[model samples]
Target chain A: MSTPENWTPQERQLHDALHRSAERVQPGPDGLARIRRRTAVVPMWRRPVVLGLAGATALAAAVIVGGVIALNDGDDDAPVASQTSTSPAPSPSDTTAQTAPPTTPPAETTPPAQSLTVPVYYVADSGDGLRLVREFHAIETSLTPIAAAVNEMLTAPPADPDYRSLWAPGVEVTAADLADGAIVVDLSAPPTAGEDPDLAAQQLVYTATAAAASAGQDGSLPVRITVGGQDPSEPIGRTDPLEVRQLVQLNDPAEGATLPSPVTVTGEAAVYEANVLWELRRDGEVVDSGNTTAEECCTFSPFSLELDLEPGAYQIVVSESDESGGEGRPPMSDSRTFTVE
Target chain B: MVQDRTGSEADDAITDLYAAHYVRLVRLATLLLGNEAVAEEVVQDAFVALHSRWRRLREPAAAVAYLRTSVVHGSRSVQRRRGVAARHPDEPPGHAPSAEQVAVGGAAADAVVEALRGLPHRQREALVLRYYGGLSEAEIASAMKISNGAVKSHASRGLAGLREAMADWS
Candidate 1:
């Protein structure tokens, strides 16, 4: 019920004056140039290989939570196509078709390929009422094409570390499709990170979308992100992914577990935010990747690497940095002993 | 299905996004900060954030909205960090207003400046975007994230407040 008609010309003039003043002072070229100068592009290859889903296999040496459904489906009955060890391509007489390398595996390859499905789960603790949240889901058929995309994202410098810890470490994945397009991800815990239901739902959305893409589908695998199979009010990632690591022990990774691939990283974050980095080493020469925040947070990065480390014993480190680049978190590091043999 | 943006394609998308939006964002930030230098810094921070979370966004089209929202958040953070209050004139004109402004009368401009110093944060933002940026009510709503009703409310209240303060000055 405001009417400028009641006001004097002087009042109107004053209002216009202040508005103009604010506009006149609006930032300009000098300010923009400074911003452009500040944000340098961090080299892509230098980033760490995101854990899990590399070239379709995630690099994260996932610490299988207790709640995991243990569904290593499609992989069980299929003959374990072993590469005739380099030791000997089995005597040619071995019926191995030595080189039938079909330009296209006989059309029969379709049936077996169709069964290549993995049900991966991303579970977040929902607090009291909702013990299990099925964040997202999808069918196996829709995701195969998305592997390349997942591999592309995973290989980038800023690979996802143990983000589940942010939701709740003790929590478990009851079920997971890992496939794109309406992926169904089930978790066995309540959302406790924040009271905002949106925040809880976001954890589900991000996990589902990420997991789905890992399974392989181009465009949006619009995950029907849900809590215990129920729809949410809104999606996640409002500002930052909510800190869900509280319920789970995202702190220390398994002692002897090894990363599935080498990692590289470079990013600038603020002190308060979490800066997660995954390190890969071959023969003691370690490659570090991930962004730690510096002042003002966003910083240009120009570091990178892509290495193929043969299976063997090596040490991988997880480093956390605060806004000031002050190393925080438990600062976990350990030597892992594994052999391709 | 959102196009499966391949790694190289995504990078190009990002570069393209930066090229297209960087300047506009800086301009937006400048208006918000009331200073070009600070505006650039704010806009830069927003872009960096956009880059970091590029993988998480379900739809790449939403990127512009994300950046706009980030600009607001970043400016607020900067304000809090600098302990910025209605900016005070520490020194008069680092450059002279020149001959044309001589007739406008320094006192009237001073009165206007003082009045602006009195408005609250959201009010200032709305008014700046409305008149200065030549943005419509809907545009302001998108930028500030409030409903059109809320924006109209803020603008109305802000302009009224400015008028009252100016009356006090004269």
Candidate 2:
């Protein structure tokens, strides 16, 4: 493969350039730890040893299976129907034992319907400009996922104080459904298109599509907006995320999670040279500060860093470095507060 | 050969693969997705997936291939969901290329990377897996789930686009 005779100068140049560009990307040190945490949570049936153990003791297997089902039903009952249907009877003798435990508790504990974790989008002012930020809200309603999410986007106050809905208050989603590979959303009133009309429209598009996806519908479909029985215009589709999303967003260690040692911070950013700077603060005082680079420069890429610290409440603020030396708009930033126990 | 492998053995194999390929795979995904955070998540998900299916795929060679295929497919899903926004169309007007260009190995490299981002998804995947990943035509074909002939066509067409994009550099 290294034979020089077959290589063109352009290809060689590209190879060198690609390596130089890619060499800057360093995976976080906590990657294995993160993967281990995830793998540990995978269903026991997927592991051979666990399956072997389950095969040996039918009663024990039934109990374990029932326990897993009970736990899952507690969190979300919508998927349990399909799960029980597929794994109808792991053991013929214990079928009654297993099925009886899972079926009863849900009916007693849960209400008539299950609530969905809907991804709701809101507009936020960042150093870069106004951009869309997302928050997941557990919405309990009879409305479909699309309508429920759109309704929340219009009515609910953003959990984050800095974020807000672009749609006017009292606006409600009259109906929402997927048809012909497009999401059709009808609003009770014509929305007040804010200064950035495109972004305002995107707020609806992102929210509707995100909610639909949560319900197992295609998220990429364009959204057709109808207001007061009138079509606003052509259906609105997603804009390039880099252009529309805040330059820096802190995704993990969500706003106020309490964690053990070695807390890992992960987020996305599009900054000059892909550099993201972070400051760890407590009691409104800067405690620790450091900088890390994202995978790519001048484009949105992921960056992660891990910190080991003593237990207490702390805030981590991550931002882009000012490449313009204070000339351009201030480097965009995002932050979250969490307790380290 | 499909024995019930112990957890520690699986952990050791995963650790070895992680040490060897995690950074490179993440970089490959970053190139494909242009977002490192999402790229890392994609690669990490691939690893977790590999760990779950380890008994079925016990060989290191097969594992590496699985990781590559997983990363490729993962990146494709992200791109599909995010919807292809034209690259850098929103670079604030009057904003000059930052001084970081020198740090990334000069403007020519930056131009190449930028131009590479503009190509069609298949062509970009072909070129990246070929030149950057140093995979053979057959490997690229398998990773991309396309034919060797298709890989060749995408690579040639992608190179043409890069050459045209970087014409000033030449």
What TM-score does each prediction get for chain A alone? 0.29, 0.61
lDDT of 1 by residue, B56-108 (tens): 87356678778877887776677665423222222232114445553554446
Off by over 4 Å in 1: A1-341, B1-31, B53-64, B82-110, B165-170
Local accuracy of candidate 2 as per-residue lDDT tens digits, A1-341: 33446889888888877776676666544465456545545332233321232244445335533432333324233342234335431222231233322212222222255587788888866644578887778778766677788988998877654466776676887666554345667677777655678888999988998887777766766676765434434556676555576767777776667899799999887666677889887754568998999987655578999999899998787877655443344455676778899
| Model 2 Cα shift for residue A241 (angstroms) | 1.8
Candidates' C-alpha lDDT: 0.40, 0.69
Native contacts retained per candidate?
0.24, 0.50
Per-residue lDDT of model 2, residues B23-100, tens digit only: 999989877767665777789889999998998989999999999999999988875554222211222111233567
**For candidate 1, lDDT tens digit of each residue in A255-303?**
2345554432232211123334445544334453443332331121122
State how far residue B102 of model 2 sits from its true place (Å). Answer: 63
> Residue B17 lDDT in model 2?
94
Tell me the DockQ of each model, to 2 decimals. Answer: 0.12, 0.20
Candidate 1 docks at the CAPRI level of incorrect
